[model samples]
Target: MLEIEQFLHWQRAIGRSQNTVRSYARHLSQFYRWLAARGIVWDELDFRQLCDFVAVLTAGLPPLPSRCGGRAPGTVKAVSAAVREFYEFHRVEGRGPQDLVLTRNPSKLPRRAHSFLAHLEHRRPREVSRLARPDRQSAETVQVIDFETDFAKLLAAASTTRDRLLLSAQYDLGLRVGQALGLRHGDLNPMRRQVMIRRRDDNANGALSKQKTQFIVEAPRRFFDLYAAYLLGEIAHVDSDYVFVNLSRPPVGGPMTYSNAYQLIERIGAAAGIDDLNPHMLRHTHATALAKAGWTAAEIAARLGQSHSASADVYIHLASDDLAEKLRTTEHLVWREPQQYRLKGDGDGAR
Candidate 1:
């Protein structure tokens, strides 16, 4: 445990956010506990032991009291990363074996194309190498919901002004759920119509941004109206600094948790007849709308607080489908049937 403390201290010393340090600690603690239960010493950890640990995690064995179900691919990948980092730390400190290895393969195109144009393009194909470490599975394509239309329905279905504002922040300003929940009253500048997303280690209810940098996003005047109404009406007596809070009986005046936000969205979505509504989906919907409106990749990235334009590629890809549809629709407009020619009937006696 002292070693684990040392590792966490090292992480913080290097400027890792508190949320990140906590995640690393949780993942490492789980791994160490599993090792202790199996009588596996740290010095004995190797490739085979790592594989077994992954299998146990993937299978969710021994049935932990919390989250006893099988882990998702993303969860498995995160756990793998934490374990690898822990081993690497010990190995660097000369306190553990240095032979541990983790394999990862690069993303590549598949051999068979799903479309004729893809086959004709002759994209380079790649196969998994037996010697390489297994790569994480690709994430599912971003779902493109009609933000302007669906968001209206969501807002209409919301039971309170707070829920309506929460939905609006994510869709209008492209905020992650954590960012939206982390907002404070002072973070808003109504005169400028902008809100700041700050990075703080003490926000127990909110996760820090991936980039860990403070940035501002435009919040329209209408959002300010809803925000003001929520501030002075629903949560007027609450003393919390968090912008969003629970209005229910059990946890009134408490900061809203991710689960709380998810359940609220789920209920509202069911009421609105929308499916799989999530905060990130709203972000994606916002990005797609921006891309369709002729925003450059860099501009979209800046608005979304992404570090680079590369992350905007998914939105570009989504817009490509729209472009294809437009091309199909305009085909007749750009193309015309050639005029047919008729021979003159009065040409004297033919040649």
Candidate 2:
């Protein structure tokens, strides 16, 4: 527990954005509980045992002495990665003269080892993880709402301009909940109609950017309209520098926290008669909307402020009729517009 606490503090000191530090703290806490329940020493785990931990997570089993189900593969992988970092950090710090044996480097392994390649159908290097569930977030796809219907309902149901702006940030700008809440007034560029997502560790609400570096995202014209209205109307009296803050609620000038966003969105969802609506679902809707509008996978990733196209791939779902027509025309289904291909392999210039 002391080591975990130290690791979290060091993460913040080293300029890890607030969201990442929170994730490391949150997941490490869960891992600590699991280790306690199983009576397993975390620092003493061998590489194979660490992989087994990931395998157990992949299978959706609860930790010992608990009934809660497992997290998704991406989340589990994140936790695993954090644990590896924790061990490595302490090892390098010479705590217990510890050493990380996971050895993520592939160069250390023998090249073309026949015995190791025997059952390797996918050619995945080592047993570092079998938890690479590609569609791990596929459940989010079902939660997405169409742009014309449910998204409108949500916006219409919002009781205040502040809440409406929050929804717009997620839907129109494709911001994660943390990213939206972390926004400061300085990040908005009305002249350019862009919002800068700068990586930072400071926020009164403990909000943080998930992005490692700064990037700007284009915002809808209507979003800025609402932003102006919110500033003059609902949020005018708030004393916070954050773009979004508590307006009518208590502690009225405070930056919006994750819990505040969650509860507010849930209330808005109920008012709209939309069940289980969440902030992330709005982001999901944004990505899917772009896909429907012929945005390529890379374009979607850029719009979402994600670095990997694979992260954007899950949202490229097509209807049966569309798939059938595309398959009929060509042997493969193409999601990008033809011109988007010429933009690929060039930098993130498309962004």
Candidate 3:
């Protein structure tokens, strides 16, 4: 347990973001708890034990009713990576045996291998079959909503200007909830029609971008209008720099936490008759709109502030019907025959 704290501190020292460190801590804690339950000692941990743990995470072995079913493969991978890192740290400190092995391939040896035999050895970490696991997340489970109509319902259901703007940021700017809530007053630029997502260490509510990099995203004009209203009405007397603040009784001026943001969405969703609505769904809605509107993958990725197009691929897949429609239009324009050139047997086609 003490080593977990040390590992977290080391992660911070290496400049990992707070959210990442917290995730690592959580993963390691779960692994350690599982080990303890089985009366397994740390020093006795081996590759087989690690494999068993992975099975538990990927298959929900030794089923516990209170526990949710197996986690997604991506989550299982994260847990495995954390455990591997923990082992590496312990091995480096001479507190645990090496879990990885080194092997040499004589057939693929470099020309200089004879002079440097040690360099020929390649490090091979313990095996975990990533291919055998299920997808990190099931695309079919993603709930997409009718953006314009549902958004209007959300706006109508919002109790305050702040809540409305929160939804606007998520839906309009395609921001993750953390990115939206992390917004400070200065992050918004009405004149430039952009909102900056900057990395901050003091966000107690864990409002940080997944990429942990500062970037600006285009803001809807209406969102800026709401921002102006929120500043003057809801935030006028508040002293906090955070754009969103708690409106309910105690700690009214405090920064809005993630729970507060989620509850607001859930309440509005119920009123709007949209089941299981979430901030990420709004983001997906934005991405889907972009893909259907003929935006390039790179353009959509840039707008979403993603480092790569892979995350944007899901939206592209969701817009398959739109893509098919475009393809049909293209086919008609390039390959459709003139009406005057119909076959004699095709009576309906010969007009």
Best by lDDT: 1
TM-score order, best first, reads: 3, 1, 2
Better of 1 and 3 by TM-score: 3
Model 2, span 91-130: residue lDDT tens? 8888732544645445453464457557866566543423
All candidates' TM-scores?
Answer: 0.69, 0.69, 0.72
RMSD of each: 6.6, 11.0, 8.5
Task: Identify the superior model by TM-score, candidate 2 or candidate 3.
Answer: 3
Q: Note the clash tally of each candidate.
A: 1, 0, 0
- Candidates in order have lDDT scores of 0.78, 0.77, 0.77
Q: What does the lDDT read for residue 55 in candidate 2?
A: 64
TM-score of 2: 0.69
Model 1 RMSD, rounded to 1 decimal: 6.6
Clashing pairs in 2: none
